[model samples]
Target: MAVRPPVSKSNVFLLMVTGEIESAEFPEYDGLYCNFSFFYGQDWTVLSNSSEGITQTSMRGSSPASNFVWNFPIDVTFKSTNPFGWPQIVVSVYGVNSLGRDEVRGYGSIHLPVTPGRHSLDIDMFVPEPASKLQKLVSWLIGPRPELVDPKFVARGEGREITRVSSQGFVRANVNIVMKDFSKQGYRNGTERFSNNSS
Candidate 1:
């Protein structure tokens, strides 16, 4: 298991996903059409105080953003709309840890301008989840598995990555990726108002 920063009451951390389609409650599992599973630690508060009637707005520019400005529970999936039509295909997380330290981490964003239709989103168990040495050895012996990636992506270091695509008709972008150090517990974020506008 990846070491987690110690937990305490001094912090109120959160992870915000800036994407297209304005905003959306993180789907636990979309089944098949678009299965986006929560891959990392489930404790990162998505909306510190998210409640019904809380307004989430998006203004798309270079990259689409579905910014969450509220807080909600750990298991609840909050849903909102992309003011510009299409959803922010890319996703990342920002939050603070139990220590009250501010931090930002990036995960690979998936974009499929082609390959129409929904795929599957699984809470990626390959990374952060703690496993015994035997389990790791067995998986290694089982050979490798194909991973997903966004073709238009550019790595920005510090776990940050970005991708862009022009509309080519009838394709819906679905991303599912776990960033390095995502849920390492050592990660933290400074809580402040963020804009969905991308650079």
Candidate 2:
């Protein structure tokens, strides 16, 4: 018998970002709210904008710490390709202002699951800290410290941090990822079957 190539299993990719974000730089000591946006790079489109379209947290007053809890779940699909090559989830954090425009505090990214299963990552939010004039002058004369920027925070096609004259602030949080395999659904003579039948 002729040898046959094994079938590749198809998987549905789903990512969820659930965590608390602590603010340190913003002036609002109390009565602070935040919103988050998720981007998967140019190649992919974000499905269903997670819960409530976008990740918007309720107004959380500052007490022990300036923190906001958010739940952002996204559904993504990719043609047969290596999961490792998929771009990381770009999470842009912003502070809601009352007068008008929202302020961009900082940004952070996390790697997706390499395999077809649930995965999780604990990542600290990175905010930029302003540098002194002398420090900037010296850096301009010489070179900047590579250690100041974390690779995870750098988005694809974006070279260097948003602000060159700044350092990173850390806010601890956990990121969870859950992958579903919808391809394994029962099939009968090319027709799909559902667990809960309407007819």
Candidate 3:
């Protein structure tokens, strides 16, 4: 009889994410819309190419009930050998101004939940402010607002310390996470660690 060889399994783990950008609360803004995109580390490979999307414009409702609803769907999968660089969703909110031009309202980002389950996130949003009084006056008069050259910068920590920003609003997200071969690689999910620490 010939001896059988043991098969080697791949170490790569898979993460599946499905969710929705439910709504937003921008108290000082109206006629709002949003743009969403993903940012991941080089170690991660997205199985699905649905990396970006734009939400339809929505106006805020009356006082005590001012929510801009998008209900935009988000579905993506990622494969990675390590968790050092988790995926993050970045959201940029904009509003139609009096001039009928889109002006950036806020920017926010949140890391995908590490546990394999449902997660609800409230992402606080902010907008860049003018550096000086002169710049503020010029922006108010010229019809352009201060905004990041690349909104993806919100997902990163570099060069953000010098940027001045003000709280604009918050976005709500509901995500369902599924993982395969995650624990087989001897990795502890976030929930597991949380429980362990609480004990």
Q: Model 3, stretches more than 4 Å misplaced?
A: 1-5, 190-199
The positional error of residue 191 in candidate 1, measured at the CA in angstroms, is: 45
TM-scores, one per candidate: 0.20, 0.47, 0.91
Per-residue lDDT for 19 in model 1? 22
Candidate 2, 86: how far from true, in Å?
Answer: 1.6
Model 1 / residue 64 / CA error / Å = 32
Per-model root-mean-square deviation over C-alphas:
20.2, 10.3, 3.5
Tell me the whole-model lDDT of each prediction, alpha carbons only. Answer: 0.26, 0.42, 0.88
Better of 2 and 3 by lDDT: 3
Candidate with the greatest TM-score versus the true structure: 3
Local distance difference test, candidate 2? 0.42
Residues 105-140, model 3: lDDT tens digits: 899999998887799999999999999999999999
Error of 3 at 52 (Å): 1.5
